[model samples]
Target: MVTLPIEFRTPLTEGDVGALGVLERDGIRFEIDSGRLILIAPRTLWHADACHRVANLRPYAYGRQGMRISRTTVRCPDVMVLFAEPDPDASCHDPADVAIVVEVVSPDTAVEDRVVKPRIYAGAGIPEYWIVDRHPTDPRDASVEHFKLGVSGAYQRIGQAALSELEKTG
Candidate 1:
């Protein structure tokens, strides 16, 4: 198994890191920032039902696929709507083709989900980013915060929804 803190002689792109077999390892993800590689450890298993629900709402939407935020950075969103089907063997997706990126917040991931990821997604030019926060008393229920990237290149709060209250469209 590839261990943590593996050093690279040269800066590698997101595809190169994926080829090293770590991103395939359950839940592990990394980001290359300013030529520096940073590996983020996987959190314990946590899946939101809302993520799956959102995935099925539109065509070409997928769950947990890594998205290429830049030449050197890749981030996996909980759910993403890729307006078109990608090549079958593609390792990651380009943000240019992405319509929306969703993050399902777990107890331990609040800060990253609510702040860090939205900033990254916005910077990458993702048009929309949503945060699904599970209801305190009901695991099956969730609150979704929808953010739209505006003309200024920053995300603006566009709307909100309760999963339990959403009418089924599909």
Candidate 2:
């Protein structure tokens, strides 16, 4: 992990290219909460593969794309499936334009992936959210949890499927 700069501790506004540079330079993941930047763990190979698999499913789906959840928060989801083609000139897509968001969980990010992101994504009115539990120890043990936003603006656990099963059919 690259050393986090001291400046990142402060709150930032939208479209901060410098913060985006920090992400690129450090090779660390970031999630902005109320303009307060938070660190995400380095992704494992399994996590990356899961992202690729999800991205490959749809032509409009992309991996590691920045998204604006609110005016003050910018998050880069592991995989994003958009309803329509993204604007080429925009730095990040608005939450309303995203059809689904996928997070591939690592050991250090399990709680954030399973708990924090679901609430945030659901509140943003994203239709679907997927959490991929990529088992590092046992590839066969990996599974994905599917959540769908309910009318009350919360995510409800809908289904789960093993990664092995998906590979067989994918």
Candidate 3:
């Protein structure tokens, strides 16, 4: 819950237009926006573990590195699978090379995780996006929701399953 102070500013936008600041503390990540220095919330152990499990199960290279989807959109997804080998020196992965983006929801970022992030990913033309919710209304269990980008720069939910079901089968 403690974040080390760090000023991470990117000059991606036109002339003197300050963009983003990233901070990580205690395995949790945060982003500062509009000079407000708000916490972007860190991931829980359960969420982090889920990210690792997904990356390990994949047949390709993946990581929790920062992804710069657009000039105004920078995110560090829980897990990201790249289309090619990752550049070891790169600060952020190119959205075009990214295959999948997975976000595990926590209480602090529920709204952004479920709504805002999806819109940004879809706008960037990410092929697939996954939302793993630790709390769900039905059955009182975690659930995973899968979304595929539609032609109109929007996401279409394709499938969903409970975490318990996934564990039993996998």
Candidate with the greatest lDDT versus the true structure: 2
Q: How does each model score on TM-score?
A: 0.80, 0.83, 0.72
List per-prediction Cα lDDT, in the order shown.
0.75, 0.79, 0.66
The TM-score obtained by model 1 is: 0.80
Q: Model 3, clash count?
A: 0
Compare candidates 1 and 2 on lDDT and give the better one. Answer: 2
Order the numbered candidates by lDDT, best leading: 2, 1, 3
Per-residue CA lDDT of model 2 for 5-104, tens digit only, reads: 4455456657564446667666766767787777677777777888887777667898767788877788899999999998876657888899999988
Model 2 clashing residue pairs (backbone): none
* Candidate 1: tens digits of C-alpha lDDT, residues 1-170: 56644456556676466555654564556656545666655543435457777777678888767788777667778788987998878757889999999888877778988888888889889999988887666766777788999999989998887766663535
Q: Can you give the lDDT of residue 106 in candidate 3?
A: 78
Q: Clashes per prediction?
A: 0, 0, 0
TM-score winner? 2
Model 2 CA RMSD to the hidden true structure, in angstroms: 3.1
Residue 153: error of model 3 in Å?
Answer: 1.7
